[model samples]
Target chain A: MDKFSLFVPNFLPCREYFDPGNNNACPGCGLALGVRHVYKAADKAMEKALWENISDTKFFGIKTNPSLLKIKQKKNELIICLDNEAGGSLRDALKKQMPGMAVAEGFKYVATACPSYPFDLYDKVKKALDTEGKSYIHILCPCPEGWQFDPENSVKAGFSAVETLAFPLYEAVCGFYTLTVKTAKPKKLSDYITIQGRFSGVTDSEIAEAGAIVDKEYSKLLEKIQSSYSYTFETTGKVY
Target chain B: MEASSGFLKKMIKCSLIEEGTAKPYKSGAHRKSLPEWDRDRCIKCGVCYIYCPDAAVYRLDDGFFDVENQKCKGCGICHSECWFGVISMVEER
Candidate 1:
């Protein structure tokens, strides 16, 4: 009936599809919201494919950390690396271990940080999954309890993370980097860190240091995207 | 006529409550703010009712959308999802 209704068509009749009425999730739980967006997007994407063609296609769901050691390691057609900040480090480790997995093999590796940028993240993930080879999607879901913030501020924190460049929204398809939610003027790191109780004790110098890291990484992403011939051609259509 | 002291005592006694009987425990009490309906602004599209995580938003008998406060956790999903920007979260006094 409604546009939002289309996102959860099959699950709406159950009444507790996403929230599941009687759960113990605290009020303003951002993780719950993140999970809902991610799951709905993935499920809806899969459903569309199933509806179009039941035969000649198969979908398998695999839940694992980026650390290959945690699960029985095997090459998957699509590897969705859903993580918080801690999980991002693990993803980095996996990438370091297998440098050629994404670029040389042309595996779709999408690394994103927040659900507040849902459309960009979801659409990229779906596109990556649709491709032939292995794909990895990294999502950063902030925890209110663990991060020491009021549950209601979860969405705000998520938004702040992106705006402040603490979690730059981007996707790396076949080792090519592209910034998704490109803010015209990014906010300072303090704007993001001040909200979360976990960073309450962080000093001014520490914030600056973290800001430097974000800036460096962002510049590197820009350079990587700029140098790539495909990205250049895709954007300006005049390849060097 | 008031009840007798003996009957009052029996009524006060604690008993084993049924499992899962505490479903939908007055989440409205936890809300810091509640979504206020703007009838004039609302297009009666029912987007609020459909996207509400708690399913607290409902259509009234006259076909206007309203919130059942008892069920609303004030997640603000409706406020965010409303394309018309009709729903606004007002702080509870």
Candidate 2:
């Protein structure tokens, strides 16, 4: 109601909302956790910056990666598109990742399950703020009351939600899709639902069916993310 | 007619609130478990800052992280998510 965008790149507002543990909320009630986690959702003063320098010789540069730098600087950086124009392969590979000289080409969509862990949520928000179009942040808010777990388990639930592949974290820009977070081992769907209180009555067959569905959706996401950029160098008439 | 006129008058007389003057929220009471941050063990990973629902964890000027006593509701998220074991949840007596 108050136009609150609580750094949506950050984790769920599940446990921070109600805080049943302290506020005379019902014992074993998880609604409190959701409320408690979000208590300061609107408080900007509390934003804990994860890093000292978010940019390369600049302050508050959200999209600092080589891919996004092109868009930020309004410059057409040379891509290692052609093999002949490029130097020896081994030397090029090392310097390519060294910054400033990296290839900033194509559309990238990053899907990471755990926000602010391997990635910086502040940078993500800054990037969204700097961008000119309508952007959407999708957060999976679990109701401990409905999920039927200990209030403290909300964070665990979020981690497992990503690991189980039940809920995939992805960001799509324009038409490009990227899965930022990749789980080493995808757990079973039942493993995710078993901890929640509402899914207790689900049978094994139903879980198996749902498992197949999750796998299907995961593959579909990967397919979209794998979509590549095709470009031809005019001088060499080479397609890359 | 009178009510409508009054509403218009109020809108015209409205004053703007200053920005960045918000007070810290005092919500420490009623918390079941409080997070005790070990300043020495902290790796400054900012993990507590990210997972904290209430945004209670603050990054101090010296690169050290600390919790605001007034704003914390004892959610324990910071404690659970901290990889360095810097924050431990102690029950409120």
Candidate 3:
């Protein structure tokens, strides 16, 4: 892990993932952009962690230890070797899975989003992909069609979301909680919703009530961030 | 040569696409605008490349960035992200 410091932010992976096909997502689609960003972050995480937890199998030659990447508490007596890459079973020989060799849980990833919070988005995703447990990064992606906002203003929508405390950027890792983005002066919830047609029907009083709810949520989150309290297993989601 | 009558040749019945390929030419057509890059203003920060959803902005061997016009959806994300104002989104005529 100490090798991580050698990584300079200027040094980004130019290697492209094998994109099987072009996406048919609508232009200015927030979901598409979110997926694209997540893909990039995960690719960079894999490329950066290229040197971590690598072992060899008798047949598979050189391969990453799946258990190390996965945070399962079970201790399997798996033999590891540096030279096993020399004769391991072809990993994708059938390019499929076998039911008999399955883990109790299927593969899953933590999910999260917003474009205004790109730095926050990238950081959280990279952490999620690199970390021990199932971590999720929640991004506030604005849809033009659904939100009734102009496509050009999609990015602005994201900005307004964070600015208004409609969505607070955060990450919870190893029972340690932290707010990634702290809005010094949160804008009005009305400001967050005024642009979107979906919220056009919302009355000012109702908006105020929502703002009160946001304030309560934000303060509770702030408490978590301030206290160095390490929560036990019950505080977080099930990781099995 | 034709196979012998008693012999059976097996082949995949489904279409198989070669992996790890990108087709920028197709989506490049439906775009409404294109990004223009200013070489002088660029700091080579790789920010443009990072923010572009299509991965159209690529860094060159000389450490400068350029766009793959066909693949770019002209979303203007690169234009918006460039700190040096090196990228400008120009409407397609």
Candidate 4:
């Protein structure tokens, strides 16, 4: 299959974050390993989506964040948008390199690897990208390996992330927003912390602090869902 | 003919079962061949546990070491952790 058929734009692949020599990693950082897994999974997903239609797929990279521009429709093409939390400055740097090119006029969809935490900020970013109609936005989160948690607790972390607001699972199209909520309760962060080495030094009080932040964030998400129309998304899988 | 059969019996006595748990020798001079465990010298620090990617040596409820001979690939991590020579890796008798 022609794997890169969607003009797949990549931010930074996860492997870089886990390199032992990177020095940025803590002794027990599970998040680094988790990120590597998720990136591989996401890549597989995108690849599957592209290869399934290889006969007509045309992959491209904008090398710019979707926030900066209104993407003009290109005929018979699937565009992939990518960004990381490292900062928006890198996107600006890319735009500056192409002095005449602006980001606002470029992307149709944006995908984020970061969890949607502190929902207010997530909303502002979503609004910036949804300007040209409803767009595909994804927030992939609660990575067990990344957060220094057990690999199995990822789903629990996912719910905690959304419920506590440390992460929110939602998609926004145009001005419409829908929050994804599963019936399961968020598991204790302690259960998640034991498997990973990163949180080894975190004190109980600090964990409590993290919990409060998550709780506040989740409350906001629930409020948003109750106030807006809800839609269920059933279609998700690796595409290549 | 009697001597040949006796020699065969001795050889059979020395043989190990195909899949039984390997343990320290029950008695006699051959017992010294087993790996030594000096608990007083052990700090119970668990470096042997952490560095053991295979997780061969694990802690027991009574707070002692337990070896899984079947699972152990005979990696020298336990031997390496014994700075005071509490544990040693030895060949099977």
**Index of the highest-TM-score prediction:** 1
- What is the C-alpha lDDT profile of model 2 across A1-240, one tens digit per residue? 112332332343322332322344332222333333323232231242121232443312334322111112122111111111112221221121221111122223221223323233333333443445433233344445556677566677767877888666665554455555678888877777789776677788877777777777678667755653221234445432
Q: Rank the candidates by TM-score, best first.
A: 1, 3, 2, 4
TM-score of chain B of 1: 0.71
> Which CAPRI category fits model 1?
incorrect
Cα lDDT tens digits, model 4, A188-230, are: 6555434435556767887676666556655655675554453
Stretches of model 2 off by over 4 angstroms after superposition: A1-121, A228-240, B1-25, B60-64
TM-scores, one per candidate: 0.62, 0.54, 0.61, 0.32
| TM-score of candidate 2 chain B vs. the reference | 0.65
Candidate 3 Cα errors over 4 Å, as ranges: A1-9, A18-21, A44-115, A227-240, B1-25
Ranking by DockQ: 3, 1, 2, 4
The fraction of correct interface contacts reproduced by each prediction comes to 0.11, 0.11, 0.18, 0.00
In terms of lDDT, the best-performing candidate is: 1
| Candidate 3 lDDT, A1-240, residue by residue in tens | 424422333565556662413765545656556656655566734433222244542223334342122222222111111110122222221111211111112212332246555555666666555555334334445666767776656677777877887566655554445566777887887776688776677787877777777777677667865663434345663332
lDDT of 2 by residue, B1-93 (tens): 999999988887643355432233245655787788788876666667666555567678886677777667776667766776788988877
Instruction: State the local distance difference test value for candidate 2.
Output: 0.48
Per-residue lDDT tens digits of candidate 4, residues B47-74? 3443332334566676556565534444
CAPRI tier for the interface of model 2: incorrect
Q: Order of all candidates by lDDT, from best down to worst?
A: 1, 3, 2, 4
Clashing pairs in 1: none
